[model samples]
Every structure is written in C-alpha cells, then in structure tokens.
Target chain A: MRYALRGGKRLRGFLVLESAALHGISRAAALPAAAAVEALHAYSLVHDDLPCMDDDDLRRGQPTVHVRWDEATAVLAGDALQTLAFELCCDPVLGPAERRVALVAALAKASGAEGMVLGQALDIAAESAAAPLTLEEITALQAGKTGALIGFAAEAGAILAGADRLPLRAYAEAFGLAFQIADDILDVEGDPEAAGKRLGKDAGAGKATFVSLLGLERAKARAKDLVTMAELALAPYGAAAETLRDAARFAIARQS
Target chain B: MRYALRGGKRLRGFLVLESAALHGISRAAALPAAAAVEALHAYSLVHDDLPCMDDDDLRRGQPTVHVRWDEATAVLAGDALQTLAFELCCDPVLGPAERRVALVAALAKASGAEGMVLGQALDIAAESAAAPLTLEEITALQAGKTGALIGFAAEAGAILAGADRLPLRAYAEAFGLAFQIADDILDVEGDPEAAGKRLGKDAGAGKATFVSLLGLERAKARAKDLVTMAELALAPYGAAAETLRDAARFAIARQS
Candidate 1:
C-alpha cells in the first residue's frame, strides 16, 4: 500500500475520481476503481524499470522495484499489482453489480496487452522506427503507449458515473494525446525536481519525442493545441467536467 | 483461427473446458471461452519467444514471433491479441449478460500479470533462485509459473459452464499441479522431434524441475497422485465432471 501511494503523479487517478464526481459518481464508490487504475499505472512503471527494458534505477524518488529487490521480485510485484487492479474492481463494495461490470470492462480494455502493453511495445519499437518517424507514426505510438491508458482513465471515469460514453471517450482521446505532448515538453524544459525522472532521457534513449522531431517551439505549440482539443472535447460536458478541463490545461502548462 | 488451433499443447484450454463441462456447461458457449483462453496462451508464447526474453527460435515448429517479425511488432501483436481475448468475451452474443461479465472477470483474473505474467517472472527469477530451492519453494514456484494459468483456465471453464465455483476451484488446483508434473516428466523423457522443443533444456538451463530434483519414477508417481487428488476435488460435481477427471489423468500421463 505504501509502495502504491508513494511516487505516482496520480494525475490519472485524480482525473478519474474527479471526472466520476462530475458525473455524480459517489466518492465512497469511486475510490477502488480510482485506485485500480493507479495500480496499473504503477505496474507499468515497475515493468519499465526492468534491466531488459528502460533500466532506470530511480522512480518516485525511491529505488525502483527492481532496484530495491531483484528483477524477479519487481516483476512479481508488478504482476501482482496488475491482478490487484482487477481484483479491486471486482470488490463487491464498489457499486451496483452492473456498474462494477461496466467499469471492469473499460479497465480491462485499458490495462491489458492491447492497450498499455501494446503501447509499451511500440515505445520499444520507436527506438528503431527508422530514426525520425512520420507524424502519423509518432501519433500512433503515443496513442498506444501513452494515450491508451489515459483514454481508458477518462472512459473509466465516465463508466463510473454511468455517463454516456461518446463524449467521455472523445475527451479521453484528446486528453491522452495532450498528456503525452505535455510529457514530451517535460522532457525538454520541465523542472527536474518534480518529475524525479531525468530530463532529456528521451533523446538519449533514441526515443522519438515531439520536441526531438518537431523542434521545441513546434512541439510546445502542438502541446497547446492538444490541450485545446482536449478542453474542447470536454466542452459539451460543461461544468461537470471542470476537473477534466483543468487537467487538459495542466497537461501542457505544468512545469513538471 | 487455424493458427490458434495448430500450435502448442491444448492442455490449458482443454483443462478449462473439461472442468466447465464437469459442472454441466454446454459446449456451445464454452468453446469460444476456451478459444479466448487459448488466444491468451498463444500471445504469451509469442512474447515469451522474443529475443529479449526466452529468445527461442522455434515454437511448435514455426519461427517465433520475434524471429518472424521484429521484436516490436511481435510485442504489439501480443498486446493486440490479449485485448482481442477480452473483446471476444465482451461479444453481446456470447452469453447472457450475466455470463459475459463472469467471463470477463475470469479472463481478467487469469491472463493479467498476476496469473501467467507473474508466473513467467518467477520462471525468470528461478534462473538463479538461491541455489537449489527446497521442495516447498519449488512447489510454490511451479504453482505460480505453471499452476496459476492452468488453474485459471480450469476455473474459467467451470465458470463458463455456469457451475458453482467452490467445487470447481478445488479441482482446478489439483489439475494445475498435475499439469506441471507431466511437463517436468516430458523434459526427462521426450524427444525434440516429437516435443517440438529443444529436449532436456530444463536441466541445461539450471532451472529446478520436479523430475530434476526427484527421480523420474518419483516424479511420474507424484503426477499420478496429483491426478487422483484432482479427481477427488471434482467428486462433488459427480459424473458431469468426468471429462475434467479424465483430462487430469491425460494431462499427467502424456509423454510430450
């Protein structure tokens, strides 16, 4: 539990909880689903830190799971954490039986291999996606790696509130893209103190980043555009989606 | 679909369907659920064969995914396939609404990091798990690595059949152990021509096996005992579980 809470930005979890609230999903019911997504986010981080993968040693300002334990234990913890996410959703205390099922479906869609795992695979692929990629390929990579999880987070929030899925999904895709752009910006100029991850690693790793391919100014402008698109997607949602809209601005505007 | 049929031992999917049938599950609904489980099994094989992980060149006598395509595509395909498994279950036509939810819940439990992925992580860890493990540790390792997925498959079958879970789970555990034992025996006796894997690679890998630690005769005997135990666990379901009972025997008795 301590490990679960310590380091994640929890922006995704917060977005989920807040969006669920916008749709009038009760706080009592939203926490487990909220935490489940967080567990998945955490699981991805742990796995990314493996020696065979990203091989980072520090995360959330503490030793990465693989660093603290052996690579095997870290792998086990991540796997356990993933299972725990679904288990939490299955918890009977969350909501009505039907609501629980809907949330599970959305969460499963986001957390599985096709969603985030597929994205990770692509991220790995991007290292060799022919040096600089075409804009379309980069967009596809971000959508899979970063966007899919965020989209799921947004859609899951809507599912939590029993909200209609169309608008929720629209907001999800926009925000997911926006978040990745913001992440790209962070790689260029964000405060090192806050992200806990070293800056400029994207270039070092030969990863394709918005700034790397698009130039810093263009990338920054694109980030703003994505944020706008995200906010526009939620416009139909009105004040109920305030937190979501703010998240859009925060995605691009934040220092870290 | 044909690719799904042609590769590998049908052990996991078979165990699942038989257990479900034991609880009087109709084959019509169970077949797709079995396929869903099989897809997950196949996806895992695809990823596991990647150069970064197992690095095997052959799986069921075909070039492994990473070997056929680059690692990234293989990874992405695995992710896509995992999502496809859940998508298959979510099909509106698959079952009653209630059963669809159950299927999703079961798949989420089995395929995610907790079940098979966690097991694989441990398998990686066991590459050097503190000198030879105690028999107890070895059992725990096998349960996580091999037993969990098989157990998940069996339990899924039982659930798909609409069987009450209590009796189904007990048999699931027993068959899981039996399946692992037979695998260990195959490592000792099987020819690569028949087995479709590099024969005796287990000993060469320094990985502990039930047969490796115990004599071959003892391993074979333990497997038989496990099958009997599996049957006893299914006793409450009576004659309906005959396929499951026989499957446990077949699972342990098979040469390769």
Candidate 2:
C-alpha cells in the first residue's frame, strides 16, 4: 500500500490544503482530508493497472502493484487503501461531527457508483463502442472520472470551516476539465521516461480523446481556455487564491 | 451492482436490523446501515471470488461476478458497491450527524487494515507459509476476517440507540467465533447443494482450520460453548433478546 502511494504530483492533496487555507481552516485540520484523497487516488491507480483492467505493467516509473507483487496482494492492497481513505476522513482532528459526516458523504458520492465508478464503467464499455464517443460524451465521462474527486478536494476546506463551497466548486470544475485535457494532450506527446508509464496508450487503442477528437493544436487551445476559466472562477477568492490559479496553469504546462 | 448483491444469507445485515430492533430503533431508521453492511459484504465476496483471489466460479449457486460478467465488470462493481456502503451510511435518515459519523467510523474500523483486510492479508500469507498455521494464529485471522464485521453489525444498534454497548459487544464476539467454527465444521461435513458453494475447500487446500486443529467433535463442542456464552451475554435484555439467542444457535446449527 505504501509503495502504491509513493511518487505522484500530490495535486489533489494540495487542493485540499490550499482550499482549506483559503477558508481559514488550519493545515492540521485539513491534512487528513488531503491524505485521504491521495490514498483514494492511489487505490484507484492500483486497481486500474490490474491485469484485468488496463493491464499496465508500469506506474510512476516503477512496476505496478500486480507486477511488483502478486495479483492477490495488489487487489487486497487497493482494497485496504480505500478503506484507509475513509478511516482518515473519520479523524476527529477534522472538527465538528457534522462536517466530518459531510466529508464522508461527499467523498463516498464522489468516488462511488454515481461518480468515479460510473465513469470507469462507461470507459470500459467505450472500448467496444460502435463509434468513438462524441465530445459531449467524453466530457461527461471526464467529469465523473476526474472532476468529482478534485471537486471534493477543493471543497473540503469550505466543508470543514462551514463556509460557502460554490467558488471552490467552480474552480474545481474548470481545473478538472483542464487537467483531463492536459492528460489527453500528454498521450499525444509525452516522454514515457518522465511520465513514468506508457504514453500514447489512447492513440494505440484508437480511442477518441481530446487530442483525437480536437487535434493536438486545437486540444492545446481548449486546455488553455479551460485554464483561463479555472482562474477566472477564483475571482471571489482574489489574492488568497493566487496559488490555486497558479495550479490551474501548471496543470496544462505539466509534462506528466 | 444488483447482480453482485443477489442471493446470500444476508447474515451481517440481519444482525444489524435485529440488533437495532432490540433497542427500539425503527427498522426504517436502521435500513441504511443494514443495506450498507450487506453491500460491503457483497463487495468483499465479489472481490474474493475474482481469479486473483479465491477464484471461485460460483456463489450462492449462481455464477460469480467475474464468471457471469467479466473481470473488469466484477472489479468495478465491487469497487462501486464499497463506495455505496459508505454512501448508505451517510443517509440522512440514520439520524443525528454525530451518529452517522460514528457509524462510518465504526464500519471503516471494522473493514479496514486492522479488521477485515488485515485478516484477508494474513490468510493469503498463510497459504504460502512454511508450515500450517496454529490454532491460535488461525483464530486471530478469522477474528479479523469474519468476526470484525459481525461485531460491528451486532453493536450497531447500541451505537444507534446510544446505549451501553458492552453487553452486545460480548454477545457479538462469542457469536462471531461460534459462527466461524460452524463454518469450519461445514467445510469438513456439508452438502455442496445445501451450502450453495464448494465445501471441503480448507481441507482441500491443506489450510489450517478449527476442525483440523481441534477435531470435529471438539470443534463442535467449542462452538456449542461459544453459543452459550453468546446467549448469556444477552441476559440484560432478557425476553427482548430471545431472537438474538436464536440467531446464535442458528449460527452453529444451520446446514448452510
């Protein structure tokens, strides 16, 4: 489980910390939520790389869980890590019971059937799709696949502080879409060495992605636009959200 | 998800509902917790049946998730069901925010590293052990893998009613152990048709089990003793606990 958690951008964790800071929630109070999101993300990656899933042998520059260990260990490790995420959310350090309950509920919603799992199911079904997915279909898929967790991470602070979550939610929505577009862009042109995993898998599969549907140049432009929207959504936070705005820009610029 | 959840004894869920009823908690109020545990159990079973895990092709006389659908679907369905369990716990109908949070925390504790997952990991490790596990080691493993969830289910009502949990906790501990012993006995002597799945698997795998260590007669005696202890723990509830006593007896006597 620890090996699986090692080496990542830690973007979702950062989102939790930064958003919590914006809401005047102490770093200590928010750290658990940050760790929780990271653990959850790690679990997803572990399972996604399974022999029966993407069947990837590499992740984050190291052998994937199933490749490093046995398949049973990989499966059990992922399961345990997921349970750990929820356990982290139950930490008393997070503050009021109501807020803690809200975090549990929100995380469950974001990561469950209506969210990440739904997106994954659609993605699997898409493999045998009669035709490539439309832009709108892909958009919806990415919303659940990537957007929900980011949304939860960004909104964690507001939930902790019992403040309005609208602004962070808007920022998360734009930022998440930009992030997915960036991933799609990476699939078109990325160094597998730096990325720490096989690149161009979408293209190899002949699957429709942002790059395939929009072309590389147009996809880059769309990503830039989404980043701008992400930044603009932070107007309510003003200077306090500068770091978050910078994160949006970094999402597009990142190579891996 | 629906297919994954079909046809099981629903013992964990039944424990929750019955325990809740003992404390005068309404069935409707407890339904989410009931459903949540059942969903969690179903998810565990689905994953356990995967090719990488127990590799079972049948469950409750029906094709296992991976056998009926595909490995990808089984994985996703199990993942989704796990998320659904936490979501169900977050149901507003569960009552005060504090209670809901408590439920989430308890369930997480029961199902995570120190609980069910730990037991599973140990079980897997035991398969490759230099020698068969001792009675003590097997006992510890079963407590985590199977007993923890039962403990949680039995105590959930007390948690909901905010009553003294010590008695129910005692009842649960004894009942859970007895339940496991009965299962070991079934492995030694059970009809595949009645049990709804393969029997003699433990002996077939040369895995250490209660019956193997204690012999059939002594294992049966131990289970009877535990059931007695389970019933004695419910003395405080008196006549209101008769149903629970019956459940304890049924655990040892049931053919399935």
Residues A112-156, model 2: lDDT tens digits? 888888888888888999999999999999998889999999999
Q: Which regions of candidate 1 are displaced past 4 Å?
A: A1-5, A49-55, A67-76, A111-114, A204-208, A212-214, B1-6, B43-57, B63-87, B104-131, B205-207, B232-239
Instruction: Point out the worst 10-residue segment of candidate 1 chain A by lDDT.
Output: A71-80
TM-score of model number 1: 0.85
Candidate 1 lDDT (Cα, 0 to 1): 0.71
User: How high is the lDDT of residue A31 in model 2?
Assistant: 97
List the global CA lDDT of all models.
0.71, 0.92
Q: Write the per-residue lDDT of candidate 2 for residues B1-256, one digit (tens) a residue.
A: 9997888898999999999999999999999999999999899899988988888998888899899889999998998888889889888888888888889889999998899989988998999999999999998999999999999999999888888889999999999999999999998899889988888898999999999999999999999999999999999999999999999999999988
Question: TM-score, each model?
Answer: 0.85, 0.98
Report how closely model 1 matches the true complex, as a DockQ value: 0.31
* TM (chain A), candidate 1: 0.93
